[model samples]
Target: MTRYWVRAFLSGLALSAATAMLTVTASADKLFGAMEKAYVTNPTLNAARAGQRATDELVPQALSGWRPTISVFGEVSRTRSSKEGVPIITPDGPDVDSVAINNATSGNVSIQLSQPLFRGFGTVNQTKSAEARVDAGKQNLLATEQQVLFDVVQAYMDVYAGRQYVVLRRQDVSALEAQVKAARDRFAVGEITRTDVAQAQARLAESQSFLVNAQTDLARAVASYVQMVGQEPGKLSYPKVVSIPNSLKMALDVAGEINPQLLAQAFVEVARNSDISVAFSNLLPSADLVASAAGSDPDFAQSKDRSSAVQVGAQLTIPLYEAGAVYSQVRQAKQLASQSRIQVIEVARAVRQAVASSWNAYVGLAQIIKNTRTQVSAAQLALNGVQQEYQAGTRTTLDVLDAQRDLVQAQVLQVTAERNRVVSGYQLLAAIGHLTAVEVGLKVPIYDPDANYKRVRNKWIGTDVKTVE
Candidate 1:
């Protein structure tokens, strides 16, 4: 009896060791590797960065108002006409006669320059609006980066958890197969009924079905992993749960301060207010300095008859009325600005709700993890007792099967709970705006949205558009 107890203890220990081996906790490096790959290679992230670069172009467009525009234009044309009572004097005297001229060629060339001195502060406000929008774009890009990183975390956890589930189901099936063999042996010796054998077989079949489903889930997870991480998933280790704020209030505070969506919306309000200024600017006068130098030739011949002139002057235009267009635009801009302010409030409320929800999920998963672990331990102990009692003819085969089923269910719960706990932590981190490549310290080159912005922000003359990778 003592030997039997010792053997059971060793068997339980071995089973625990095997289960622990199956639970592959992915290293920090592996988690970071997936995030880094997604950061540099994910098409969604790359597209967002490209969009931010496009937003940078607005700055240069706004600055164009402060710069001089220079242009050169030329025209050559032929004239044909009949002249009446016209006389041409050639080194002698003038005569009056009926003259005809045909196909007279003339050419003119001019270079003009204009520099805007003022546009009723329209250019100033426009530049301010564009700058604000660029800031918003950067924040939006950061938000996208967080989303992509969160997705990668989820995919990694799913694949890892799915594979572990398949392993657990396989173990359950194998155990049930052994139980069926034992039941058959007992029946052959007139110790048990055929119904006992059938029960074990039924449970085995159910376990096999579960294993198949787990495999399918794993395959789907792999496909998603490939899409998000831009490559095939390898043996992923289970991720450690991310650390988050201790309470809901702390989480909300962090989110309000750093959440990219909220920040982006605030910048949008600034941009809209600048737009209102730009619209009202139309009611004021604009001033510009215009200069031009030109040469005109009456004939195609190179002679002293060519006339050239240079002119420079300032121009001021005061708008009297625009059919109510300017007034309507100003009103529209004010309304939109008001709407943007309201949107900022809406966004803040939404972010607060999100942070609260994420905090609840994180805390809930922690409790679930604890309860599932306890359930696994208790179920394992109960299954061991039931198996021993059945061997001693003190428990029915059905009771033994029930205990085993309970153990299997507990194991599945534990595995799923662990996965959910990690995912919830990652989500909480994202909700607080910390799920970024740089925040996670991924081992890859961080994309700089400002690099491309600075490159093309003041470009004077170029068609090649620079974009962030």
Candidate 2:
């Protein structure tokens, strides 16, 4: 009998090891690989890049003011005329019963070129404004990249924690099932009362319900993971904690320098200031160099009645008055500039706030993780002790059930705390502007937002647009 029992124990142990191996194989996906995939495939990040490319066109549009415009025009026409006169006695021979008709066809073509000499410095100011806006757009793109990556991190962690919770709940359900059976066996042997058996059965039902809820939550988390990463989640490995500044003040200082949102707002303020100059420029004089060449035939009946000419001159226009429209535009621009300045301040404050909050949360989660780990260990010990005491008749079935429940809760708390710690660490990195793909060393090509700008900014003629791969 002893040899038979030993063989059975070894067989069960081998089966458990095989199951663990299978679980490990199924979850071999690593966090960084998932992030790299999302960085390449996320729609939100790609859309932001497209939007930035569109913004780059503004530079060339503004530069057009400094270039000459050429145009050609042509015209063709036919003319017919008839005259009738009363009969006259002498004079010319044809005057006796004079009637005359004439027909003529003529064509002409002309070309003109105009180059802006000066536009009250509007071109310069507008170009400056457009360039600033493009810079701001690049920063916005960076912010979008960070946001998408952070979202991926968040979803990955959620699914990771959700999977753990489901496993714990399943284990809890299995433990209670065994406890319920043992309780029934004891009651049948008159070693325990019906009440104890009922309590054990009730706990088992509750654990089963918890297991179902945990499973549902895991499904939702997987759906979210798919949405963020643009694919189904594999078994996710735990993400490594990202580095952050050592002190809150240091974090704030770092954020002030590199935070994408804050820098974008600052660029907006610069653009707004340039806009004020552009609007004020409208009230100043503008000059253009205009040149044209033309040829015309006045009448087909007289082939010699042709003329050609070339003209060159400078044209100047001073805005004396525009019914107060230009003045109102100038005022509007000034107000907008003022608003942008305030927005910069607002964004700076918000960035600092985010940095502080993320730092605090990260620190707090670390403590929670430590405490929950301790609680899990203690609860496990207490459950083992209660189970042994119940077998010895020194503890009740209720005690054992309560101890089991405590252990499960502590284990769940530990998972949650650890998950939150990872997430908060990422959040802190994002707040300090360090959560970008390149900063994280993702093994993918870094997207240079300026590449599109450089390609399009100086292009004088092209209907074709180059898209980034």
Please name the candidate that would achieve the greatest lDDT relative to the true structure.
2
lDDT value for candidate 2? Answer: 0.89
Clashes of each: 3, 0
| Candidate 1 Cα errors over 4 Å, as ranges | 1-29, 79-103, 187-195
> Candidate 2, residues 52-81: lDDT per residue as tens digits?
989999999999999999999999999888
Per-model TM-score versus the true fold = 0.85, 0.87
What's the lDDT for all of these models? 0.88, 0.89
Point out where model 2 deviates above 4 Å.
Answer: 1-27, 79-103, 189-194, 299-302
Candidate 1: clashing residue pairs, number? 3
Q: Write the per-residue lDDT of candidate 1 for residues 1-469, one digit (tens) a residue.
A: 9999999987975675556456645543377788888988899989998888889999999999899999999999988888877887755677677485767689999999999999999999999999999999999999999999999988998988998888998899889999999999999998889998898888889889999999999989977887798656666777666778878888888899999999999999999999998998999999999999999999776577799999999999999999999999999999999999999999999888888887887788888989998999999999999999999999888898999999989999988888888888888888889898777777788888888889988899989875544
TM for candidate 1 is 0.85
The C-alpha local distance difference test score for the whole of candidate 1 amounts to 0.88
TM-score of 2: 0.87
Q: After superposition, how far is residue 428 of candidate 2 from its true place, in Å?
A: 0.8
